[model samples]
Target chain A: MAGVRIALWDLPTRIVHWSLVVLIPFSWWSAENHDLERHRWSGYAILGLLVFRLIWGFVGSSTSRFASFLRGPRAVLAYARGSGDKRLGHNPMGGWSVVAMLALLVAQVGLGLFASDDDGLETGPLNHLVSYATAETLTELHELLFNVLAALIALHVATVLFYLFVRRDNLIAPMLGGSKQLDAEPAARPTMARPLRALAVAAVAFAIMAWISKGAPLAW
Target chain B: MRTRLIIGSVAAGLASVAMAQVPSVAEQVKARQAGMKSVGAAFKGLRDEMSGTPDAAAVKRHAAVLAGHSSKVGGWFGASAASAPGVTTAALPAIWTRNADFRKAASAFDVEARKTLALANAGDMAGVGGQLRALGGTCKGCHDDFKAKDD
Candidate 1:
């Protein structure tokens, strides 16, 4: 059974995850403290990570697919009932939560690109296009959603803890190590593709994200 | 025909009265120039201290100046508005269109700047730094919304 289970989260995913854990809060703190230099760099790093994760969700691995784990009502219900296979990757409901978190975070970071703290001291690069009223509204909404993200993160942590204690699942460990110890089973798996392919995908995503973030300026 | 003539006369009288009541561009310009001069001088004083060469004892005196003149700046906004009929100051149309928001920005600045001044006077560098940031935020904030961009 152990031999059958293939590596799911490749090295890039691990780097992105751990980097995000450090960068997200640091970005928030730097912005809050008016550390403009740090805030700007943190924002760029976030944009990079978000882009990488999106690409990884598509062509990276089977376990990483939106199609693989993003399931319907029955799947979620089964997951809630705790009868589903505790596979090597995200369960259905957890997959959707990941999607939601990623979407919200993307929005938060995207809006931050256009928001100004109303201080001429720190205008986002794209603030030039938006009107003052619109900019102010966006800034407020961006901040308000930060609190919402924090709540969602807390709920995520709580769920992980609950699963650990109640369901005897080591979800966090799998995230950290990219492997889960499952019960006795039959072996059947395929080899993961080359890391260079993953790196190439990441490069493409980064380029696309960079282009979109620049407002596709030449198109205008 | 007689009723029509009478109505025309009445309309003319009211029009003349309204014209008499309105202030001209020159009058408005003069008022804004005066207000800007006074406020600009006060700000210059603050800038001097903030240039990283502040005298601790002078902070108290300067705080009084900022406190006294902040209301004066608030009053100037009104006076300038009354005088300048249509010139776009950094003051947003929302100042008049959404009066509450303008007031909030102004009020917040006043409160925070005072707190900043107090912090400076106390020689609480960290507290003063935070308050200064807050004050700067409010100032830039109101201007960004209400005032026109420099362009």
Candidate 2:
């Protein structure tokens, strides 16, 4: 069957995904170099991205929505059995991996908000909210969670490679270009969520992040 | 026969003396960790206070505590506990492998801490902040090569 290029991932979804791809490793590098200033900025960016993704999950385009991808056990089983649809968006098994990645990222950023370096010099923006001992514990948890996130990310890349090679699917290409080759035009062209709405959501996310970075003063 | 017995007795006596000098490994590890925690706590206190309205008296107190801990750091780290059985520490083997450099780092921290105390006493808050960063850099220098990484 001849496949036609059709719209798939919307602009916001593609932007968010690509931004995270860059930010995650950059966060790791900053931490490794003891560049707390850079690390903190990266953390703020990640938090903003996560916030946007969470909101977008509810209201973004069809392929980007949780309701569209998250499926029941039967669906997952069917997917495992190689009987599920593979034309576009997240496959059933892949949906859970997406959720897990998002959940781990949330935990990582949340812990980072209260973490401090061993010397007590480099601290999270909201480190003031917790006691010193509590901050230390959060720092430890933050370290531990990064390990988990790194492991999941390795798994994610390996899975994508598996699809690329074994399954003969080019998952990476669509994420970059925002369209998939479908045998027929999608029954309904994906509802590309409005750019104005994405901008509004992004503004809210960055505002909240900036406020927190300032220790979230009570005066305002 | 008498000479042989006398030499054996002397060696046995000296062996006991040497054994006595070797401190309890467990206690050393615990005490070393306690020193680091106290330093960390004091440093954290000073940092937190600086973030807002700093109490001069408290700044002096925290700086004094930091100085006290820094002075004792070289001793705590002098003896390697990396190979102690049934005990665990984040101190990497390099702390001992590069022993001279490790001691130098510990000395640098001590110098910085004493200077920090002097600044606090002078009520030079800005100077104190800059010194804190210098002090932290000593920590980073040591941590970079000597300490195990978190991630």
Per-prediction interface RMSD in Å: 10.7, 1.7
Give each candidate's fraction of reference contacts reproduced: 0.14, 0.62
TM value for model 1: 0.60
Identify the leading candidate in terms of TM-score.
2
Q: Candidate 2: list runs displaced more than 4 Å.
A: A1-4, A86-88, B1-22, B78-87, B90-104, B118-127, B141-151
For model 1, residues B16-133, the per-residue Cα lDDT tens digits are 8877665455555456556544443344344345535566666556556556656555544553364355664455566677767877887877787688677877786556545555
- Candidate 1: list runs displaced more than 4 Å: A1-6, A185-187, A212-216, B1-151
Judged by whole-model lDDT over C-alpha atoms, candidate 1 comes out at 0.68
TM-scores, all candidates, are 0.60, 0.82
Among residues 3 or more apart in sequence or in different chains, the pairs in candidate 1 whose N, CA or C atoms overlap within 3 Å are B90-B146, B90-B147, B90-B148, B91-B146, B91-B147, B92-B146
Q: Per-prediction DockQ, in order?
A: 0.09, 0.47
Please state the error at residue A127 of candidate 1 in Å.
Answer: 1.6
Q: What tens-digit string does per-residue lDDT give for candidate 2 at A21-119?
A: 999999999998889899999999999889999989998888889998999999999889989584368999999999999999999999999999877
